[model samples]
Target: MQEIKATMAGSVWKILFKEGEQVGANEDVVILESMKMEIPIATEKAGTVKEIKVAEGDFVNEGDVIVVVA
Candidate 1:
């Protein structure tokens, strides 16, 4: 399993995919809201989304695991 982490402190803005969904390398999975900016988070490797660790509107700190891929 691989964890996808938040790059910065922020609230989860949106989730583009769901658990068990297929994802491609560098595909945008989540968008975060920080400092009024939208930051799109992508998977580093292609895999199935095993779980979403965070939900939309939830706050997360930098390096917090947001999703699990496998």
Candidate 2:
């Protein structure tokens, strides 16, 4: 399993994949909004999305797990 973590403190703005969906390496899985900028978070490897640890409008800190792929 691989954990896709947030790169910076922000509010979750969007989720690009659903649980159990297949994802490619470096695919953007989530988008976060911080300081009025959108930041996309991507998975480092190809895998099935096992979990989404956050929801739109949720606040997260840097390094917080946002998605899990396996």
Best by TM-score: 2
TM-score per prediction, in order, is 0.97, 0.98
Among all windows of 10 consecutive residues in model 2, the one with the lowest summed lDDT is: 36-45
Worst 10 residues of 1 by lDDT: 1-10
Global lDDT of each candidate: 0.96, 0.96
Segments in model 2 whose C-alpha atoms lie over 4 Å from true places:
none
lDDT of 2 by residue, 10-69 (tens): 999999999999999999999999999999999899999999999999999999999999
Residue 46 shift from truth in candidate 1, angstroms: 0.5
Kindly list the per-residue Cα lDDT of model 1 for residues 3-61, writing each as its tens digit.
99999999999999999999999999999999999999999999999999998999999
Count clashing residue pairs per candidate. 0, 0
lDDT of 1 at 36: 97
Tell me how far candidate 1 lies from the true structure as C-alpha RMSD in angstroms: 0.5
Model 2 alpha-carbon miss at residue 5, Å: 0.4
